[model samples]
Target: MSFNIALSGLNAAQKDLDVTSNNIANVNTVGFKESRAEFVDVYAASLLASGKTKVGDGVLTADVAQQFSQGSIQFTNNALDLAVTGNGFFATVPELGSLETSYTRAGQFKLNADNFVVNSQGGHLLGFPVNPDGSSASVSLSTAEPIRIPTASGAPTKTSEVDVRMNLPAGDSYIAGAPGNFDPDDPLTFNNSTSVTIFDSLGDSHVMTYFFVKDDPNTNPNEWMLFAAVDGKPINLVDDSTVPPSATGIIGGNVSGPLQPTGGVGGARLTFNASGDFISQIPTLADGGIITEDFTNHLPNGADILQRVQIDFNLDPTGPNPNEPTQFASNFEVTALNQDGLAVGRLTGIDIGTDGLVRATYSNGTSQPLSRIAMVNFANEQGLTQIGNTGWKESIVSGEALAGEAGSGTFGTINSSALEQSNVNLTTELIDLISAQRNFQANSRALEVDNQLNQTILQIR
Candidate 1:
């Protein structure tokens, strides 16, 4: 009976040591959960011939239960590196040989040679696929699928309207010989300019320049005029400001200051030609201090305003700003464009969000969401059986898998450029190992003593 007890201790100790060694070995392994060897004691049972108590004997290996505690998070620069903050696991279907869905907590992923997002084993991360319009669809991937970034987002259209915001100083004086050396006649020339590269309906690029000219060199502080030109062609300004060109009359402002002197700051209206070039019409009094320029004056000046040219994609084949728009409720407006827009662009890069949303940005002023990441969870996590390579297989005990997006329900947020390390703890394992070693040594001593006693009895006999 004593020998049997010693043997049981020996077996249990060896198993415990094996568990500790395994934990220590996988300390560096990502997503590895340490396991514990459990033992059950057996009691002797005596059969009752007449009326006797029954007892069972010895101890045995009961189970090796894995600890599912989360590992400490480590930061990796790669955006594809992912980590689970809370619960749930990453699902990957093996690509080599037989196909089987495996679950893992490890999120060390990289883009494959084929440009497909994949893990070390080439298994693709599954998620909801997206359409060109940045909408998602229900789908799953067996491996990381190749991402598609459009070369040219779309063809350019006509320029409808523009918005600008800027600061123009009214510090300069209107009278030259005056105390401030004010010279309202010579308005400030607009040299501070920006260009936007816009594509024509024919897919041709045209640079547009917007010039801001301040007319009120003195009094009406914030008054300024605007000028627009495309490829150096004046498009919106008038030919002459003094004389009326057509029935539209003179678009210049009424004369304000002295008769012979060039128009002073106050009465200036903005005017431009067909090519978008602009000029300001200043009003000067004809000796009688009479207001000359009126509604016919087109070069209207106002407060210092920042100007911007924006492109409105009118998908509607119908006329501009159609009453009822297509696809989009109205029309997608891309504004605050310089010259025209970013140089004729191509798709350049892609990124994934914590919620598993994929976005693609283009060299042009265009961007779209590509997809959403999908996460799966199991009911019985402990029931999951290991399939090597830090992957797990679903067993009858694990129940069915529940799928959803990150931050939804029990799913954890996806951390970009990070990976989850193994949950194995060396500290606890070392302590457990010492206890197991002592038990093994004591069992050995007991077995040796038992054998010595048996030998003495034999010798005496």
Candidate 2:
């Protein structure tokens, strides 16, 4: 019985030493949780003679409980590296195994040659996949696919309206040298008009030119006589009467003079028809409107004139004025402004939130959620059977698993670009080692004393 007692102490001390050694070995390991060995005293029971209590037999291993306390976080420069700020595990699918999903607190992730984000063992990080636009969707991938970025997107667009802005040269001569028409330094001497191209929903082009021959150039800068034309035909858009006055032009608006003038005086009113022809009372102003000084293309309604034209039509068509895109039945709002109405983006980096949301960013100032990671928590962490490689498997005693999002319920948030170091305490381990060594020595001394007593008895006989 005494020998059995000493042997039990030896076994218990050996187990204590082994557990300490494990802690020290994994001190630098990521996602490693320290553990403590538990021991139970064995006892013999007699069913028939029940009196005071059963006699003690020896010590036996009860269990090894893992400590789940969070470790200190260290910052890492790698964008894919991660650490758990709170409580949660990173889900990864191992490559060589059955590709079964496993959870861990290690967050050291990296991009492979193919650009797929993966862990040290090439396990892929699950996430929601996104289309060209930084939108979310429920998509799954077995193998990590390289991030794909697009150059441009195709959107609905057409020539809608044109904006005209320019400063006409002040030094100018109308009709060569018409009376009150020549001034080199004074801005009140010339007339200014502008033409712009507009496109309909069907992409048809139209040229709208406003003729502004200063009625009173010296007095009214804002109060100019405005004449409008389309193609080469005179268009009385404001009133629609009296054949736009041909060479005499329409006599309307604030005017301090007449339209007709002498030769070389360059007082001309031009009209452009939608059919792309320029009818001139005189040629269009060379440097007074939207066109270039040498521009001979007076008609603004042509395919060639709208090669780079973009258009946005207002939907209200009424007060809002500009054309609007036709709305779809769904909740999506469609808008048009240029070449393609689609927004642009480029791949920048990736991130994983505590809730297991995989996000991707782009150079075009866009972001998208690719996927959500699933987590599993066990009822009996101690019941988990070790499978080496810092991994554990489900056991019958561990109970069913509880799976949910981090920071929600019992699960915790995950920190990116960090790893969890082993929770081993060297000071405690060293102290425990000393105690075990003393106990081993005392047990050996007791055995030696028992042997010496036997030897003395034999010698006395």
Candidate 3:
């Protein structure tokens, strides 16, 4: 009985030493939680054996509980490194497409060869799918999936619509020096001109310029000729309205005033009232008030942009409005110039918000919402089972994992470019190590004394 009691004391002390040593060894491990060895006094009681006092047999090793306190955060240059400030853990999978989930506090992550976000152990990071507006689609653990970054170049989109708003100077001489003769080469031929860049199906860009030729003021006071060109080639707005808007001359000078479009060339007539308000156009706007800028064979790169690039002056056909382009007596100014077109862009960088939304920015001045970093919390964090690699698995003691977006409800906010260090305290671990060693030595002496007394008893017999 004495031997058994002494043996149990040694084992308990050894367990304490082992636990302390492990804590000290992993002091620098990221996301490592320090553990403490608990012990209980052992004793066997027999009914009616002792009425006054009973002695405890020895110490028995009990549970080793892990401490789940917050760790210090270390900022890094990598944007993928993440840290949680308050509560929650990052969930991951052992491999891509594998549902076997694991939770972790280590945020040392990077993009793999396939552009997938993974940890040092190659476990893929899981996240919730996001909408285009950067909102999480679902916060269920079952809906979580491995996050994959898109590194490939983004496809280009054609210039389908364009909005133009400007003021046609009413103070400028409609017929300055000579009758209006539309000519892109000579600035004197047109009063004002503006150019816009449009993209083709192949992602190539071409300059589409609009030339406004103020008509002879005396004969037609509020009239002008509208001509368009693409890449220095005249695009007939009428006949070539569909394809190959090939034309030699759009409009020529009429010394007597009025409007005269050169033969084989097409031009739209702009009419306005004396109040400088827009009244109508020669060939009124089509069904949707769209001016089809056709450049069929004019495009050298073989882009069939026939009636594809439509222009909207942003004018209200219902009645005269202040927002519409006006012949105001002021300097020519383009108030609004917008186009819905995109060029093939390369991935520039990534940004992760505090809410765990991950978005990718491109060189084309465009951003896309990728995913929301999934945050998970367990009811009993101390009850988790350690599976190495600074990761934990849900055990029976720990409640089911609760999935939610970061900064939502009880979930902690995600800190990007930061890492959570180990929670172990070296000073405390070292002190515990010394105490356990002394306990082991003292237990050995007790066993030695018990052995000596037994030896004396044998000698006397």
Candidate 4:
């Protein structure tokens, strides 16, 4: 009986040493949790046995429990590396469509060959689908799916409207050429010119130029002629035969000649008051300050696009404080220029928000939400069964996982470009190692004493 008790003590001490050694070994491991060995003393007793002098039998290994305390965070250069600040685990799947889920605190993640976010072991990071407005669509565990970032964003949209605001120099002399001598190609014919790049339906770019010519200052000091052209093709505004002919074609009005079929509304006649303040724009200043023009025959791709392009000034012509083209003494300058058209975009980078929303940025300066990472918590965290790779599986002892987004309710916030270090304390584990070693030594001495006593008894008999 003494031998058996001493052997049991030896075994318990060995188990304790094993647990302490494991904790010390994984002190530098990411997301590693420390474990402890618990023991209970055994005693032989029956229902009618006397309770006064019951002797203990031996020690038993009760259980090996894991400690799930918070780990220190280490920041890294990798954007996909994630860390949780509080209670929660990152849910992941083995494959794209696999429903079998695993929970982990290890967040060393990277993009696979197919651009799917996965860990070093190829486990896919699961996330909730996000709406167009960057909000999570659902929080159900069943609805969580692997996160996949798109290589591109929305399709190209042709330019429909362009808004421009500028100030024209007021003190500048009239253009050298009169109305009849005005020519788009001759720099001396116009006082100032500005060009803008516009996109077609096929994502092709074209240069649209605007030329401002001061009218005959002797006869019309307050009048100015605006000439428009696209890709060197002059856009006619009026039907005056008095104007010089363009190399592309003869200039005509919106109602007659070659310009009529192109939906040209003719050039604008800007009129300013004596105080250099804008009084009105010619062609009756159409609704929304748009100048409609047709480019059906000028498209490079030959595809029929929305030929009618509306040039919007964004200033309300009827408003009391309308900001129109001003004729100031300052040099000619363009204040703002914006268009609604966009070209095909290439994926540039990705950003992860604190709320676990993943957004993808494009080369075209556009961004969109890709997915929202899913966070899960168990009712009994200690009941989780370790499945290696620093991950855990839900067991019957652990209640169902409660799914939620990061920073929602009791869920924790996600830290991007960081990793959660092991929770094991090397100092404490070293101390435990010493205690277990002493216990083992004491047990071995007891066994040696028991063997010597038995031998002495046999010799005496």
From the highest TM-score down, the ranking of the candidates is 4, 3, 1, 2
Candidate 2 wrong stretches, greater than 4 Å: 48-55, 96-99, 127-345, 453-460
lDDT agreement with native, every candidate: 0.57, 0.50, 0.80, 0.79
Backbone clash total for model 3 is 0
Across 1-461, the per-residue lDDT of candidate 2 in tens digits comes to 76677678778878877887788888888778888889999877777855476567778878777887888787677756777655555556665334565556666777776555677777765544444453334333343233322323222234323333222232323332222343322334435445554433334445655444433434432122334444433332211121122222222333223333322122233332223122222222222221111111333434333222211122221222223222112232223223221133456677667666667666544566565555557787667766665666667987655655556777777766666676778788888878877876876776677678778989994
Model 4 over residues 101-209: C-alpha lDDT tens digits?
9999999999999989999899999999989999989989899989998765555667777777777888778755555566678888778888888777766778888
Q: After TM-score superposition, what is the CA distance of residue 276 in candidate 2 from its true location, in Å?
A: 32
- Backbone atom clashes (below 3 Å) for every candidate: 57, 36, 0, 3
lDDT per residue, candidate 1, 284-374, as tens digits?
A: 2121011222222322333111222232222122232222111222222323443333333466776777777877776666667866766
Better of 1 and 2 by lDDT: 1
Ranking by lDDT: 3, 4, 1, 2
Give the clashing pairs for model 3. none
Please give, for residues 1-461, the per-residue lDDT of candidate 3 as tens digits. 78878889999999999999999999999888899999999877899779468777888877999998999999999999999988999999988778889999999999999999999999999999988888888999899989999977767787877777787888777646433345678777778889898788767887888777777788888776777677776655542233233322333332122223433345567767888787776555553234543555566677654535666665566779765677878898988778888888899999998999999988888889999999999999989999999999999999899999999899999999999999998888888899999999989998998899899999994
User: Relative to the unseen true structure, what is the C-alpha lDDT of residue 117 in candidate 4, on a scale of 0 to 100?
Assistant: 96
Residue 55, model 1: lDDT of 38
Runs with alpha carbons beyond 4 Å of true place in candidate 1: 44-56, 96-99, 131-136, 139-161, 164-195, 201-204, 210-229, 233-349
In TM-score terms, candidate 1 sits at: 0.63
Clashes of 1: 57
